[model samples]
Target: MNNFVKTTVLGGLIFLTPIVLVVAIVGKGFSLVHGLAKPALQVLSVETVLGAATIHIVSVVLLVLLCFLAGLYSRTAGAGRLGNWLEKRLLEKIPTYPLLKAKLRSALQPEQLETLQPIMVRFDDSWQFALLVEQVKPDASLVFLPGAPDAWSGSVCIVSGDRVEPLDVSVQRIIQLMKRLGEGAAPDLSQLRFGAHEA
Candidate 1:
């Protein structure tokens, strides 16, 4: 009876999670549209327009215009700094900023940053293999290997250059392979090796 109850609960959650997420997304989108439309319609007096169609058209046009102007302003010298400052301040206030920043920093770091040393390891001694980025000296580096669905929530490992074998592979190719076969797979680097020098 206890096992039956647990199985039922697990199955219910598996079915309900996607439905819950979709409903949440729809609610958020509706709220955003309402926020944008309410103030614009109040100021413009939608009653003056021919009908509902006219009101919707005007609202959409206004929204597009506002977005375009905002984009243009952000690109300007003075506005660019202000926009960046505002974004940074907003991100700092969020509770999840540190977690998000750490994940993003790991994924987006330049290839040059990984130049210390590379190692090839049977990651976790499982079928999955990965090219580990090596850290130098007192300053250690953390590589967050992304998992399925949420890339941010992955295994974090402290690794150094001497332990990892560097693969002569482009970042794009690695990303493509990851997307196809996931973190369990490694790209075939043997084909990419240069010819041996004759004695």
Candidate 2:
């Protein structure tokens, strides 16, 4: 397919996915409130005392209160630890939980979290964009060279810090550029005057 079409679809999916996810979550929450409040609404004969609106209003109020209480409880000392324990024991075993949690976290974090540093790597005759995982010493860094299209598979190398010219770009942008296979995504490296291995 053409790049324009591919980019348009990709952009649409990115915009719509979170919206769909939020709507789904709210829909389920609404259903839960309806089922849970039906008996209470009927028992008190609230529909007659107030009106048909009473049932729906009561259900929504109860749902909000229930959510507030749950959030309040999760922050307390004992409940916090208990929740963590339960998550590790039960939620962690669910195959997609960790991946979903990580994606959610990355989305929620600030735009520049600075967990990784993008670097233009030059070693001998090879040059590529890579992430500086860590710098154990002043002149050495653990770098990861991510594969194009799917960056999850990559090789790690211990490269001299001198040969890795750090880029003043966000790691997320670096990943996106690599995923696009350098299609108008390469970072500016003209300012890199030193620490290049003449690639």
Candidate 3:
């Protein structure tokens, strides 16, 4: 193939790939729903009055309930550990999981302040907003300092132990500030002492 033709074909394939995948996935989901709903319709005999629409609607609702039940179970102590183990062994292998992992973690653990401990970490001369992911050691900690307009992703930096200053702020509030590209309201970090270094 000529250079122009090759480039055009590659561009077309790139555009069509996701569209085709979406269509295929949607079609398969509909087929599965139809199959499952058919049995429920026959058992309930709701199809006689409400028609086929009832089956599809009920199926979707039931599916949502099932997902909720699963999520509730995941929030438990034992099941959560199992799920985490399985995810680490299997799901983590997927490249996309690491990308969306942070987003999902926030959604799943809304009340867990420790999920992303909002902190005001000091650099050599200045203090920048950061999230404390975890403590590698008593002194060493993993921090994620996000960029504005898209705090969903960021650089993982391990700052000096003394430079890391804890902040009395919410992760959601910081995320909001970041989403606006720091053009709006800022988190109240006045409570956090940025005084002389102390262990």
Candidate 4:
């Protein structure tokens, strides 16, 4: 009974920690942006013209525009260096920032998401779902075997190239399927090329 209780509590904590952290970060960011937009709202007298509700919408628009501008700037060579320097000197000092940034990047960036390819890795008679990291040699490939229900946590394995079968699915789709505990994997796995190889 004691072991069960302890295990359950730890599981709950692991599940809730990411959610709580994301919520806290989002709330803080919105508050900061809203504060910055307040002075502009006062100068424009938007409250007098459109009422209080529109001010919140305007703040959200400003926040989105700010993000767009930052994205553009970050793409530039000079801005990229500056951003890296700021991350190294300031942002990295905050423990959660690096993890949060990586998660956000993988979620938002198409190029980054493309690097983690969904695949099936052979293990004796059975094949396992995995993400292909890269080919270390002509015949050996490095892959990540993600834990079910928690796609981010996983182990890396080096297996023969022939043992890896690329799946025709998006990284996000695979992650969602994993989070659903393999409930809706049939449609995705239906396209497997194993039969062709066997013949």
RMSD of each: 8.2, 6.3, 7.2, 4.4
Q: Model 4, which residues run further than 4 Å from truth?
A: 1-12, 39-50, 85-103, 124-126, 166-170, 186-199
Q: Over the stretch 1-199, how does candidate 2's per-residue lDDT look in tens digits?
A: 6999998797566545555766787779878898878887688765556667776787788778987998899779999899899998997885445544545655766453477788888867667888888998888999888666645345789988778887887878766776788677533656666433554
Q: Find the candidate with the highest TM-score and give its number.
A: 4
Model 3, 1-199: lDDT tens digits are 6999997786566445545655676667667767887886788766456666787777677666766788899779999889899898997885445545566566776677457787878875567889999988888889999766557656898876777877776898888778787664443764666656544
Give the Cα-based TM-score of candidate 2 against the true structure. 0.54
For every model shown, the clashing-pair count is 9, 0, 0, 0
Candidate lDDT scores, in order, read 0.53, 0.73, 0.73, 0.79
The 10-residue segment with the lowest total lDDT in model 3 = 13-22
Put the candidates in TM-score order, highest first. 4, 3, 2, 1
Backbone clash total for model 4 is 0
Better of 1 and 4 by lDDT: 4
Pairwise lDDT winner, candidates 2 and 4: 4
Q: Write the residue-wise lDDT of candidate 1 on 12-130 in tens digits.
A: 66445545655675566555666788677878776754666655666556656766787788679999788679768785675445545544454666554354232233333332224
Candidate 4 lDDT by residue in tens digits, 36-85:
88888788766555577776887788777887998898889999899899
lDDT of 3 at 189: 61
Give the Å shift of residue 51 in candidate 1.
4.3
Query: Roughly what TM-score does model 4 have, to 2 decimal places?
Result: 0.69
Pairs clashing within candidate 1: 118-164, 118-165, 119-164, 119-165, 120-164, 120-165, 134-160, 134-161, 135-160
